[model samples]
Target: MDYQNSLAFAQEQDRQDPLHHFRERFYFPQVNKQDAIYFCGNSLGLQPKSAQMYIDNEMYKWANLAVEGHFKGEEPWVTYHELLAGGAARVVGAKESEVVIMNQLTVNLHLMLVSFYRPQGKRFKIMVEGGAFPSDQYALETQTKFHGYNPDEAIIEIFPREGEHTLRTEDILQSIQEHGEELALVMMGGINYYTGQVFDMEAITKAGHEVGALVGFDLAHAAGNVLLRLHDWDVDFAVWCTYKYLNSGPGGTSGVFVHERFGKDPSVLRFAGWWGHNAKERFLMEKGFKPMEGAPGWQVSNGQILPMAVHRASLELFDQAGMENLRQKSERLTGYLEYLIDAVPVGKDVIEMITPRDPQARGCQLSLLVKRNARQLFDKLMESGIIVDYREPNVIRVAPTPLYNSYEEVYRFSEILHECLEGC
Candidate 1:
């Protein structure tokens, strides 16, 4: 699809967009009493308009039903998380039974690691991407230490080749094979947070398995942003936060996927809680820990109703829009963003796109390595009500989300950025 860096072209695309109505469903942040052009969904998505109503419904249930809300409410609190499983499963490409809405992302990662990261004898090393999200780094570091292995030795980081900004799939697969004998688990972000490079999870999963290692992903960026097939890819496990592309509230409840093979395996280690016990016998207060049949069995506590409510509101929108439709718009939206950036004289000279050029290798995010006045330029955007984010050093991350972002907004951002650079 050829893209033009003009407002008319952008407006034309917006007019033709099937998902254009989705923009009105979200409440954008106010900057100077105007709706800001939000390009920060990679960080936190705009709140859905129905989120308040969803939360209010749960609040009403709690007020009227009290403890009885557990079972007596219109949609019982006891099974609230269950209602989310199907939608969350669709978002991550997993069967309903293979997915569960549960604890925070890092916590879920730790839980999955406990079961899948078991290292025996010489096969204790964990392979991960270098410069992973800090939480993942810390989780792997602490988990290695907890298992009485020195992190420096037990953790192998796969770094991009010299001067490269993203990991090549070939390099990743080769690394997996090189450490095959000692690798116990291969854990990576489905999409790299900084570069916005979508990893080839299917190939990575196959490579890990070929090496006799379990594979998992932290899909925090990939969940609602890119197409995923955790089950078909044979990903052993995965975890994601819903707040970013999923448009759940801040610190929202996360979703987890445990492959059907591990879903009900009695031998798999997990931090068990009452909620994860067999629902039929749960009220009996039985002494034994009889796990639920699938992914819910990994739940360590009862659900958080309010967060789950907000999540449900957004998931409903996703259900209506469909991931495939969203992806189609996303490619064009992000492609237009890339095109506009390149067409802008200042953008071409001062901004370097670190994200993969191929649509299939990235989601909505494009990480710009700003050559000059990065902070000032980011502040300029903020002052102009163009919502985007700046990372440390020189990177500015822009995400033109399909659910709410507009192509015209992307064009406007390029104009603003060009003006900012000219002023600099």
Candidate 2:
């Protein structure tokens, strides 16, 4: 597994990789008929090859069956979302009834907030990790305001002590203890978007529950990149998008998870729609809404089939390969990336790894804090056909996806980065 500045060693690792065959399942993005070394799977995953066939089938059904497609088509457009649950459950480590493929990430967050963030009197405070994705921060702020609370006072933003890029587990646990009395809910990303730090979910969940506050996560960065056990960890809810790591295409359909414990709670207060109504009674067009007794009860409408079809297609591949296999490859692939990044002479002061060094504490992403123009370095890599992503200011994110990226790709990227630094 230690390639150690050895290209031959890297190639040997690739040759021996059991999951190497899974790389061919994706349609690698290319220019001039060559497969690009795509390390930006953290931003957007390469499309699964089966996605086309799945969408094509749905397209043909829609074209020929028209309105009848909902009830009579082979897949039954009316219940298309149901097809996604089993795969999603496996991905997030939840029961089938606890996972639901529904609206986009942000919308689902707002919906979960409706049920979980019931600010009452002294316990009106909501806690969110500092430096959360902008969309999540905005959602929390807006939701707090909607409840007639000043965001500054009601929303507690927990940050690492000064000079730390990532929060310490102890700091998070302590914050939860200090604010537990006033906290209504604790919402955080499973893996931080920028630093790639995977939070201690078990600790967070237990702390939040001890204070009688609901806990949830936005799993956009973690969904397919890391293994989760939401059910055992006692997470109250979670939301995630399929574009990143899930390889469901850009801005594709999203999913939600609600603990089975809350499935029948009438007071859960979801934003209901026809799709959420009991399936058997749906055709009856009953005057009142009787929600399906699971996470599907949160659905607002039948999901757009095109995107869900693509997601399903991607999930089929994931189901076949199994997450354990992916995680095994991922650990080694990402470790190789870390080793390469460290081997190159970038000057210790010029480069710092913001991601946790512990394998279990991070996914495939390695967020580099560059001292100079990170964007310039990023552009140079792009020109040289080594694709990586740049966050604003001076950070470059390199995600060597195990499903497609090779150890050789990581070594080549290091070589290019070293060359780029030499010119500057």
Candidate 3:
């Protein structure tokens, strides 16, 4: 695909895009009262227009139906979260039984660690990336500490070689093998939050299994952005948030993926909760915890109805559009963003792209390692109504999402970036 840096070319592409109609379904934020060129979906997705309606419907059930709402209404509050399981499974490429719409990402991570991160005598070390999101780093650290092990000694951090911004697959796989018998678990983000590099989950899962280790991932950045085959990859478990690419709402419900091997086997250990008990005997309120058949068995509490309502609305759009179709558009949209950025005058002197150039190695994000006047340039971009976000120190994370972002918006963003660069 030869991309031209022109509004006309962008408009032509948008016109031919099969998913173009989806752009109209979302409500973009106002930049000086105009619809801003929103490129922050990687951080927070634009709200779908139908979100309010979904919330209203639930609120009505809560108001009128009261105690009976759990069993009454078109979508019963008791089983509401179940509505999202099928769509959620499709987003991450897993079986329906293997997926659970449950607690927040970190909470679910803790639940999974309780069940899977059993550090035995000789094999007690966990492998993770050097600079994972603070939440994940904290979760793993505390989990290790709770098990009475020193984090520094019990954790192995895999880092990029000098002068490299992204990780090498060979290096990661070799690191797992080098730890061999010492490695108890392999936990990492499916995509690096800062670098926007998508890890080879399948390869990593296989390598970890070869070394006698259970593997899991925080798909906070990968869930709706990249193509995942968690079940086929034979991944042990995974957790992700619905607020980002899934476009559910701020602090939205999160999802978990548990392979059937662990999901069905009641012998596997987990922190028991009432909601995780079998639905048939739920009202019985018995002493013994009889866990459900699969991933639902991990549920700690009942559904967050309002948040899950928003999630249901967003997921319907995902199911209608499909992940394969979304990924198809995402590659080209993100590529166009990179192509334009690369064509910026002075290139590496002004900014260095840290994200992997290969489309398959990334999703919709392009992390710009700004070199000169980083804050000034970022401020200029914001003042010019381009809604991109800036990280601490130097990087500015820009994302052009496929479901709602347009090629014309991408072209216009490049033009504004040129203007901001001039000020810098």
Question: Can you write out model 2's per-residue Cα lDDT over 36-155, one digit (the tens) per residue?
Answer: 889999999998888999999998998999889998955898988889999999999999999999779999999999988998989999888999999999999999999999999998
C-alpha lDDT score of every prediction, in listed order: 0.92, 0.89, 0.93
Please give the range of 10 consecutive residues that has the lowest summed lDDT in model 3.
Answer: 340-349
Q: What is the TM-score of each candidate against the true structure?
A: 0.99, 0.98, 0.99
Q: Which candidate would rank higher by lDDT, 2 or 3? A: 3
What does candidate 3's lDDT look like per residue over 296-399, in tens digits?
Answer: 99998998999998999999999999999999999999999998887778554788899999999999999999997899989888988999999889999999
TM-score of 2: 0.98
Off by over 4 Å in 2: none
Better of 1 and 2 by lDDT: 1
Q: Which pairs, if any, clash in model 1?
A: none
List the candidate numbers ranked by lDDT, top first.
3, 1, 2
Total backbone clashes of model 2? 0
Where is model 1 more than 4 Å wrong at Cα? none
- Evaluated at residue 420, the lDDT of candidate 1 is 85
| Model 3: how far residue 28 lies from native, Å | 0.5
